[model samples]
Target: MRNKIFQKLKQGYSHLGLGDDILQAHAEGLVATGLVTDENIDNVVNTQKSFLESLQKANDARATSAATRAKEAARKEFEDAAKAAADEKARKEKEEREHKEKEKEMPDWYKTEKAASDKTIRELLDSIKTMKEGYDTMKDENDRFKVEKAVTERKNLIISKAKELGIPQYRIDEGFAIADDADEAKIGEYLTKVANNTKAQVLPGNRDMFPLADKQPSVENIKSIVDKLCPK
Candidate 1:
């Protein structure tokens, strides 16, 4: 079958310059047997093959360009996201640093309270040293010596109690100066009054550095404080 078709195709080509009837017979034979028939069959096949190859090359180039564009776009997006994250981190760090700076700037109430506490601690230390010195020197039996010793001991007891109870030095000093003749129990009671009055004046949400109840000091409490101070 294939040989017949080839023979017809060759006959068609061979009769290209022959008489029209003979060429037509070969052409008709080729067409009937399903062989080559188009006048420009070779040129058209070559042209079509070249055209398809060019089309495939063009499509491949386009695909490569699209991939390059996608890669560039993804890189730019990642860079933008990274930059935004860094900026956000810097913003939060700045906020935290500013907040810490604000905290370092102490408020007026804190400053005042700190100063008072410092003064209280200082005065208490000094009074303790002076009282210990006086106590070491009280050896004479004279009335003057006895009175001086009694006064020093009493003041020492008051100072020690105030220091132990976290009472401010100012209140202790003021109470002693005005009511030095008061008994130890009465002195404690008076100090308690001063502490309560001071607490009443304190602003809401502010804690008192030296807090004391309004209740009067009991004899037992006074005795305990005295024993601790003078120690048998």
Candidate 2:
């Protein structure tokens, strides 16, 4: 229908020397002579308005499609960024574990130094233990309060020395808890045994400083502490 209107306009304006100007002198001459009616000019105006409306609708559709495409692209980019961040975190954790494993493979010099340090610590502990034993033997002779005070001081000294030898504070505390009823000599031996290993070092051969004769788990020992669980 729109095409038909354009054809009509062309035929009517042909006599005006191809000029579609609304007020062409030739067109005006035709209109005054009644060759072309006012209806023909009105038709031309209505045709242009219809064409402009069609073009605007096409432009609006294109803009909507472009907005949709832009939104989808942004969503895809966000997903990719999230995946990349998770992968980077996993890579860092793996690298840290590998680094720690390498560190655990100590050099020969470090082992020798550690062994000598252990020997020195053990000797100091043995001397301290001997002194404590002498104090214990005089338990009846010495004032009770004086003996308890001396034992507390010796225990503190042992804890400080153990920390200096690189034992973790928690392990020292655990040792004290496990050896609360043990004599000062036994406490020295237990700490000395643990002094060679890294922080939070568990006793390799035995978990208990005072194992029961029945070989049963008491309220103090939890199996999970000594055993590593398989992942589900």
Candidate 3:
């Protein structure tokens, strides 16, 4: 539309031999002949200016709307991509968890019994090592009864050591055994872990207060302690 209007204006201008004076004289001639008036020329100029302003405003609004629409489309595409990525991650994690659960649920003779025995072996090993170390450290006393006191003292020392190692739960009393049907290897590994956890250092003379056996002294013999304190 602008191109067409500009072409028309050029045509009119060229007809006047590109001379501003000729254009002005021609316009005045029309007014003198009563064909046009000054008020009519002024009104036409003002109307043309207002129409051009409105056209420019409409063009600006159209450009802004196109830009906004493009941004919205791009944002939606990115959002879809992110959602798909999250869904894939969640699915993989769920599949892995389900596979692990299936593995755990499948039980067998070797798995169950061996695991239990292993547990028993671990506890026994740690307890025996602790008992032996504590027994060797005690000073000799004249009375045979003092042997009993010394053994009990040793067990208490081991308990304290276990507690210090951050494994108070793993600390074995005089008598603790895995279930009869426990897996030997698993039980052994557990006992080893317990022993490792219980292998802790302590300050001197505090062993007496934290006795391994409370109701009965851990002295003289483990069999006696087990029978009296923890028959199981």
Which ten residues in a row are the worst by lDDT in model 3?
197-206
Which portions of model 2 miss their true places by more than 4 Å?
A: 1-39, 48-50, 103-232
Tens-place lDDT digits, model 2, residues 74-156: 99999999999999999999999998787689897987898899999999999999999998878756677787998788778
Query: TM per model?
Result: 0.30, 0.28, 0.30
Candidate 1 global CA lDDT score: 0.62
Weakest ten-residue segment in model 1 by summed lDDT? 203-212
Clashes (candidate 2): 0
Residue 214 CA error for candidate 1 (Å)?
99
lDDT of 2 at 199: 25
151-193 per-residue lDDT for model 3 (tens digits): 6665565455544444435246534344544454555555557
Clashing pairs in 2: none
- Candidate 3, after superposition: displacement of residue 47 in Å? 2.5
After best superposition, candidate 2 residue 148: deviation in angstroms? 68
Off by over 4 Å in 3: 1-46, 108-232
Point out the higher-scoring one by lDDT: 2 or 3: 2
C-alpha RMSD values across all candidates: 32.0, 29.7, 27.7
Ordered list by TM-score, greatest first: 3, 1, 2
